[model samples]
Target chain A: MAYPLPVANVRLKNLTKQFDGVTAVDGVDLDVADREFMILLGPSGCGKSTLLRMIAGLEDPTEGEVYIGETMVNDVLPKDRDVAMVFQSYALYPHKTVQANIEFPLKVRKVDKVERAKSALAAAESLGLGEYMSRKPGALSGGQRQRVALARAIVRKPAVFCMDEPLSNLDAKLRGETRAELIALHQRLESTFIYVTHDQVEAMTMGNRIAVMSRGKIEQVGTPQDVYDRPASVFIAQFVGTPPMNILPAGSIETGKHLVGVRPEHVHISPEGSLAMTVTLVEQLGHELLVTGRVGERRVVVRQPAHSVVPEIGAEVRIVADAADLHRFDPVTELRIDI
Target chain B: MAIDQIRGGRKIGRYVLLVVMAAIVLFPIYVMVIGALKPGNKVLVNPLLPSNVTFSTITRAWRSGHLARALVNSSIVALVVTTAQVITSVMAAYAFVFLKFPGRTVVFVLFLATLLVPLEATLTVNRRTMQSLGWLNSYKGLTVPFLATAFGIFMIRQVFLTIPKEMREAASMDGLGHIGFLREVAVPLSRPTIGALALFAFLTSWNQYLWPVLITTNSDYNTVQTGIAALQRASLSQPNLVIAGTVIIALPIFVVLISFQRQLVRGLTAGAVKG
Candidate 1:
């Protein structure tokens, strides 16, 4: 990176936040390395956003401490925390021109006019918003407004960037485009990026590591492949993959006291397999066919190539998965177990 | 074809109804202008028709009513009141909307409760306070009592609530303090409502009749409203003179309303739709 940004790692220790009597973010501890793009991934109401807000200093934690680099910043104001945030709503100043919105941070810090204009122009141009500099946020499209928000966050070149589902408002196609742009921006700035999202695809594609959360708790933190392949718990195993992992009762496949877990892609139909299922439905998703069926009383989905022969509804079929692809979780604890 | 004819007939009926309503509203202004143009003796005769037109009546009324001075006095008071009310209202509304404090809702309710108390109810007490402070018959007396209104605060706050909470958070993250955010974001975003408030404040202060009559004894301190009363009292024989005085005094308000018509509509209709 050519720019000199004050890159710093973020560390949270025993952080907790409660709204009224309900706990939104429970005691949690995590560390993000310098310039690492860490993602907080979860379902809605899972407290990933609350956790991100605590780190950004927008929301105060009820307990514990937040560390930026080596300094404890629990008492510091958001302005002094050296972190910029891109909100889900974009939150660009509606009255300010795109150029002025980008320059707002510098303007508040009393930067000189010439330097502010230069930096604003450079930021806008980098975001491909050079022509819309004079336009208000109301005049720009949703994706362009999101980019302007990104430009505003980057203009000051803070140590850490906090994005709370910044691309959620954009259409799917635009979201994909901005996802790539954000990755490149993170690389170019060489700054710590902590992103919060409920989309698993975004977590897998954009994050260097994903912290999966549920019920105000971090279930597991690992790389996308690690979390997908060797999830620490059944919750993470189901949450990190499309169509989720199928969980069958104990002893459904082999004699065991644990539940069996297998990914939809790993489940296959075979003529000589052991488990028998009745086909219920099939969804053709262009390149893949999602075959849903009932194995005993549990519904299971299997991913097959689009070219495969479609099974008739209510027809019996044998299903099988390799032992290596199977995951075992204790039925009572819901935690993974090794043979 | 029958339906089209019926629709056309209904449209013409609506136009006719609108014309009648407009005429009813404009009749008084028409009478006033016609009355002002005629000599005092001819005013009562053929009041609806303009005849023996004389511009001298307006000039005479201006001189005898001390209208030039009155207009200046009214302008100063209205402008000062408008500016002060806008500042106070915006600051108060921002605090009520954004700042966290104890008893915030109770305090805001108490503030709004003042709106139910009519100005006439507090007139005597306010007059005594102004007199004790020696603001009577002065610009201070005219403008100070109405510098801030609860209605203005409530109106502006309604508009302010429409601003997303994320905007304030974003501003804070960008290093803007409360004042910075209010000045740079909140105020500019609420400009239409503020403009409407300013117009309302100016008109209210400009047309103040009872307050100005109660506080001021000196003709030198007379506002346009009080000056018009004085003109009527002095020119009992020349009724047109008083009418001309009113016509002159109303010009500024008409101009203000016409110029701010767009803002007024937008501001009034604000909060009617959820953004």
Candidate 2:
């Protein structure tokens, strides 16, 4: 059977970056298929953003090569890279009107008046910045400014789009709306997107393939399901989930398995399975209950489904999960178990 | 009532201070006008007002000093210098701020260091240079040395630093090289500072007296300041025309100042804070 061709496969081979006396991105290799929404998720000071900037050609890697499609763009200037970036700052020119800011790139490229307007209009409409065209960025609301920023990036019609925490500057509700819109927008455009964020929830929701990076090194790269269900390392397990994965010591239960990873949503109250524990505290989130307690010497969190009776603070409860669903890891190496 | 009285006392105190400062600042100008308006004989009397001022005294000063031609010459010089200074400074500032060329920072620092050297110090050397080029008394000689002022470049560079790097990056991403990006992106966004700098440049050029007097021996190319000074000598016989010429010279600059007061204040504040 013939398989559909990937849109643009990006391959980075042994990528390394250094600044001043310090190394930032260290020996990372990755391949992202065309139309893939790949997220580099990490904590602050992690080199994930630096790696994205290298991909955007804003920074040059000290060693190795980066391939976008089949082109090795190691020394290529940022402008000719045919990629656009949205900054965490939103980086909107404060003085220019929304229309002018969005039209800026097109204008520089000498994209004629009619075509520039049409592209800007199309981008603005989709991003919901249509009515505020003539208003300066300083006058617009944060959400509107963000939309204008997004429109400015999209109007370029680039082959690749790199966003460094584009939703981070927004409030919670607007971030959610913009996130959903971004996903939809990505689907409609069918362009390759490399999103860098520290927020795992954003990584989980938006990325098809998630690369968990820690301290300038990529811990794991996999499909969201693969990474979430079978995290390559303890870092990936803990980094890819909301409220994070609960990594508790299994302690000789399984050989080479010093820790077993459990998602909060997957760990349940069964009263008979796994081990018995007394709930020290409970948090009700309308849709779920977060039961925190001690299982052996390990602190475990179990998510009870909504509408379930809330367990008392001191009540004894049993945290349950299938051994098959458990992701086991070595505490020393923090690498995933094959079993 | 006591609180109201205290507030009223402070308000009155502030008004008194302001009025005193204004009078102190404007008194010299008032003196010059009175001196220019009185006949040479009445000048010794030096009355504060123009009560007994004669039109004939003013007319004799106009004829004797040839102030009309000097006024025209001054306007042209100021206009030319202002345009040249603004354009050159903007280009130099843009290059320093945005482009990466060999020796750029060194060049910029050298340019900025010139701000410490007084404009008068350069007058002798510039006049020699002008004479060598056979440009003495020409408009080119009048305006050339004043171009590319350090103040204009420094002020523009201040505003340029505040602009988003992303805009510059975005512009570059669209195949806009240095000059292209400056014109297409940076310049348009910097309009307010440009207007502010333009006013500053105009003021500097229009008020310049020493260089114009030193360089241009021919009376045809004399600027407002030099022309007015020469007018003072002729109007020793008649003060009215001299006062009128002083008013004429001061009017344009005063109007320019009043209309752009906010911009001027911002420019001054921007300069002080930036340094």
Candidate 3:
């Protein structure tokens, strides 16, 4: 049966959360479109998870409102909000088999036994967990356990699915595999997915729109390419890249009263270049080479193609980045400056 | 081969030590049984032997000591106390661990402070209170005083705390309210600890002697412990009869301990998380 699952639009109106005088989620406003895959990306302690929890009604906002699907859910209980959550630890009942775990939400809603069994079996089969229907969560591996958690959330056909680092416990290879599977599931079900993760790669790959947060506030919200190509602030530029963007002091660049940022891939090792550096280390991966060097007082890295000539560790090199590729930020405010 | 012989010798030594310890622990029970089986005239003679195994003294003890009524009274009181204690303990423990309220710590500490006051220290006052309430020689007097215990609260609270915070949050999101979560998740997860607490309350109430003697003057409300004491006083010349009463009182405890051994172990190690 092709279920017409209800999709929800989520809105946060200046939501704030404080724990013992420390603001975990400060006056943050966001809107998630119906059936959209929205990712909240940040480092640990940046309040992304707290923001999602507030939407789920697991945490009460200290100073604002949360609306889910046109209804203000601030005072509503989590279950009444018609939202499902996939926790970081999976949080599967240790005593329950996979089938029972999937059927738990349905059972709580007082669904009949035959209907519960049918829905649980369908969810499990879709997650490819049919063989593990009789196994306890402890008996399953981390990846399989996470699938059971996913099946449990979907069995009730919730409007919004809030996931808190659901793939963090898996190894790298499995995380990549699960990431694709989640995208496929989201597309098929067409339900709103609000995912939180500290890993920028996961955010860039999976989120239709990524909201980068830091210290209880949203730094920027945009499409993945928008965030990568034109970061709103130095923090976004530095936080969202692998071997993060090279930040140089204002004194080193001609950009007045502003710091210069260039991605590792944007910085080139050319004979006719502006910046001079001494190569210190070379990380040769199969597809790319990460070249680390010192540019005057600052440390810089360049991502070169694997076919490029490897530079000696102590060699002096000149690096250049196109003006279009450079991001200038006000040194004092740390906000981006359009030159 | 030499190493194997030494390992075998060590195993034998371990068995020998275990046998010695078991004998030491069981010696008193063995003596009580031997004494109970002997005729009153033969009780003091060769008390350790199995000779003259007459059960007339046991029958007399059961009849004259009013042990049958005493057993019924003790069972009712202990069962009531155990069930009430489990319910109160689980509810109180859940509130302490999960629910947030003002003065929570102060209230918890005050509750814990009750544990420091020995039950013996309050027995007299409790007996007097029961007398004033006109509940003396009644089941209410025996059971109400022990319907809840601070130790039970502390134990079940610790077990509840071991359940991760995420589980509670997940349950809430899964449409399970506080009472639903308690019934479906919290209580089931803590079955072992609850079982242990129930057994503890039952055993303590069953073995109560001082309070029963203080509040229960009528032999109809006499529990097993106090009934055994009365049997001792009445049969000073017939020691075998007292022995027979003691044996009967101790049998139920052994049966309970053996039957609930697994739950007892689990409850004792309640906070140890299993994968």
Task: List the candidate 1 regions with Cα displacement exceeding 4 Å.
Answer: B1-14
lDDT by residue (tens digit), candidate 3, B31-81: 999998888899989888988898888889999899999999998998999
The sequence of per-residue lDDT tens digits that candidate 2 reaches over residues A215-334 is 888898888788788889888777777667888786523445478787878877885765688788888889887888877776778788878878898888877777677778887898
Cα DockQ of the candidate 1 complex: 0.90
Question: DockQ numbers for every candidate?
Answer: 0.90, 0.49, 0.83
Candidate 1 chain A weakest ten by summed lDDT? A1-10
* Candidate whose TM-score is highest: 3
Q: How much lDDT does each candidate structure score?
A: 0.93, 0.81, 0.93
TM-score of each: 0.96, 0.86, 0.97
Tens digits of lDDT, candidate 2, B1-275? 99999999999999999999999999978887776667666765846766567566556655656767876776777787778877887888888887779999899899889989987787788788899999988888877787778988988888778777776765666567888877766777667678788887888888888888888888888778887788877646555567767766787788888999887777656545632
Q: In candidate 1, residue B23 scores what lDDT?
A: 99
Q: Write the per-residue lDDT of candidate 3 for residues A1-339, one digit (tens) a residue.
A: 345899889999999999999999999999999999999999999999999999999999999999998899999999999999999999988888899999999999999999999999999999899999999998999999999999999999999999999999999999999999999999989999999999999999999999999999999999999999999998999899899999999867454667999999999999998878999999999899999999988999999999899999999998998988989998889898887
Ranking by TM-score: 3, 1, 2
Prediction-by-prediction clash tally = 0, 7, 0
